[model samples]
Target chain A: MKVKAFLLGVLALAGVFVGFDLQNSHGTSFAAKKAANYDESVTLPMAKYPETGKHIKDAIAAGHSAVCTIDRGGAADRRKESLKGYPTKPGYDRDEFPMAMCKEGGKGADIRYITPADNRGAGSYIGNHVENYPDGTKVLISVK
Target chain B: MNKLLISYSQLIITNTDEEHSSFQWSDEDVKRGYSVQRGAVAIEAINNDESEIEVIVGSYLPSEKATVTYSLPFPVRADSIIVTSPGAVTLPFSVPKGTYQLHVEAIPLQQPTDDGLFPVRYQLYFDTNGSK
Candidate 1:
């Protein structure tokens, strides 16, 4: 009876070890499968630049400007649009406004444009153009 | 004890137009007009391994709907390190005024490599309006 009990105890210990090994292998296999199927793709829509407005061109030609008072809701979008490229050339009769002056408080709009600097150094400029109006005032930006 | 290290990286914009100048960017300078017509990106890396490794540099512009991918093989000797200070690779296409995410990955050419090896990624904003 003593020998039989000893043999049973050894079998139980062996079974425990085998179970632990199986669990570890299964976990590793699961992790490897997950890593093998990793997806590294990023998708984004094509960016569209705003078109030049006919009125804006007319104003610029006439040495006048049109201003859009960017309401609070439109402030963030306007700020983003302001960072976009200046129309390659001002559109003569287009219906969209791609470039504009951005103002916060009673200060001038921050106008940014691509610089002609070397490729090894910085290549853009951000200059502030103070408008002669109070905060929340609409200012028109035009090329004279 | 083998590893890959990214030592340095930078994004450069070169504008051909004279009406604009480049300015350093600040965290609070999110109000835009910043723009760039061309971008040259450079990355430096080192391999501290006994075997050859592959390095991949990828740039993804979600808003502009563009992705750039390039790969190079790096050879390293046992008990020795390989350092690379590669020149900037000019993008074939212009990086329009928008934000972009850049990803870099390195892996050993041999099998039995760790899945979580060398990976790095970051975000950048570009504008044709010249805000650096």
Candidate 2:
């Protein structure tokens, strides 16, 4: 009887451990989504020569600019943000964002990556919310 | 540990100085005229920075048929004028041409602080091109 009770207790402990492991796995995806959140930062590539034409850093900045224009609502359907050829341009580069992120269940707001044909860029629907702003709102930003 | 923190600070400052700059607009200013049938106008403010720019567009409505008022944020000079819709639009001290007037202006930006970020806003007003 003592041995049987010990086995039953061990099984219950194993079940709890498995449940904890599953919960942790789900938490990792949420953390990844948060990590991908948009924050203002300039990107530059490592380069040895300043005289080099369009170094990697300059190229990276330009690439992000193209990717930031596709955040318009109702227009970003079936679109994606390309991260290919990121450090170098004039060469073929391809990227695609998860389609699930653009769906209704996704957290995509009024701004995001859109179809490549429509300028192949990102966009925002800021003008749609102009009604909520004050009469004289201004903003200054420094990017690096 | 103290030395490591100091080294990190040095790296951040050096990186920031080498890699950052403020965004300037493609054009110094944009100008548009308003007239009859033109109730509003829209203008785009370019954000050269990596972040989004929160800006506002608006103008004071005219009170008289031949009178015109300036926008809150005065422009340095007038440039190319496009008809937003249809309204009487005249430059500062210039003659008003039609029954109504329209003008598009960029207000100050509400910058985002450590506390929170502000959304961009725009306002549109119409005028009968009248004098007060």
Candidate 3:
């Protein structure tokens, strides 16, 4: 009877360890799955050329798309702040890519146009950034 | 014979539309303190020429698909032996928040001789907040 009890206790410990490993593996797989489908939603407004904003408009009409349009208030600020600490994965540089956060009060929503080449895992990065935001915090992302 | 030369040019960014408080581009600024709060950028150009020179300013965000470009015609007078501008021509533009590489091409519209192109690359950091 003593021997059986000891073996049962050891088996229980092993089962706990297996459960923890499975949980960890599930978390990693979830992140990878999210990374694979990074496109969230189109938010960037139509891009306007300095001289002629027509090209961008026409392109939009023809199906050219903008990725994300973020609000310029506290929500936008939080998003920007979160992105600041976002770790640069392998083969990525924060400087090489242009990332503007416009704060013009009355000038509509701030738009960020990102191409596939520019945003390899932009969705995942953004998802990771907003992971800690309180419920109802708007986190918008779009891909082309 | 006159050579169109760009002696010195610096990219300045300001938070206010008034352009009173501005910061100059520095290596440290690019690495650590690069960010724009109000989305205003000023390109100060100094031309070394005896006469007026026409320059084209072209810029684009490396991560963005669209490019913003415009041209400027600068006038400079020559005095004594050295050619200098009466004052620096300030080109101001309202830019959205983002990291960008500004390329300025100063080509003499009137090139009697072969005065090679003077181009300068300035790294731009524009942020509404200090996120960049």
Candidate 4:
């Protein structure tokens, strides 16, 4: 009798966990219908480059909405338009959000100058995650 | 009786920054979805980490259960909308092709989640006869 009771208790406990897992997965409408696929999270290295972080935080603070779409078309033209009169400093690179590759990027986009290492590092990290994502793919920039 | 097309208990949203504050439907996408008619909705003050966005299609408009409401002038173009900030995703809802009158409601939950997540109920109703 003791052995049978113990087995039933364990089975009940296992069932509870399985139920919780299913409920969690189906909590979202997308998951309930079809597994939603997304590649929108991008991490920012704030500690590695405080200045770089400050520039982005400030731009976001000043009402420059982060445009999440990636266009990759007319990037050179957009970059040229935004950098027409911008000053470049020694040992620094000008970084902009709504990057020249984004459909939202162009003249008047947010621009910040930071070290080449920090600038390139950030760019590479973002590209690794979203390089192949289609245009208009929403992106979430996490300033960590 | 208004039929419930989609119901979501929790809608996740990533409040990336203050500037990216609203979740807007794509009018252009709507145009593509419908053969002759389409619609879209944009909800403001949606800084909440997550909120419930619910809509009804091909039925009568439901009762007023929102603090405020708005109707878009020109339709938006989008089969869906996506938002990603810290830990938010789109409340994925796909509607069948037809003309729609986009109605939205923003109900600020009296009690926000521990993470300060705001929940907004987006009720979009679609039926026939919405002019192009």
**Model 3 chain B lowest lDDT segment of ten:** B77-86
Give one digit per residue, the lDDT tens place, for model 2 in A18-136: 76786588786444433544222222111211211122224334432212222223212222222222221221111222211122211222222222112111111112112123322
Q: What's model 3's overall lDDT?
A: 0.30
Candidate models: Cα lDDT each:
0.28, 0.23, 0.30, 0.47
Q: Report the TM-score of the second chain of model 4 against its true counterpart.
A: 0.46
Candidate 2: segments with Cα more than 4 A from true spot: A1-57, A60-71, A74-144, B1-99, B103-117, B130-132
List model 3 lDDT by residue over A36-134, tens digit each: 433233232222111112322343455433322223223323323323433333322221111222112112222233331222123223322432343
Candidate 2 structure quality by residue, lDDT tens digits, B1-132: 001000000001011112122111111212221111122222332111111211222234433431222332222122222221000111112212322233333232355222112222222232332211
Identify the leading candidate in terms of lDDT: 4
Model 1 chain B poorest ten-residue lDDT run: B81-90
Off by over 4 Å in 3: A1-144, B1-8, B11-16, B28-37, B42-132
Question: How far in Å is the alpha carbon of A89 misplaced in model 1?
Answer: 14
Across all candidates, the chain A TM-score values are: 0.22, 0.20, 0.20, 0.68
Q: Is the docking of candidate 1 incorrect, acceptable, medium or high quality?
A: incorrect
Rank by DockQ, descending? 1, 2, 3, 4
Which stretches in model 1 have alpha-carbon errors above 4 Å?
A1-56, A59-65, A68-137, B1-132
Which stretches in model 4 have alpha-carbon errors above 4 Å? A1-39, B1-132
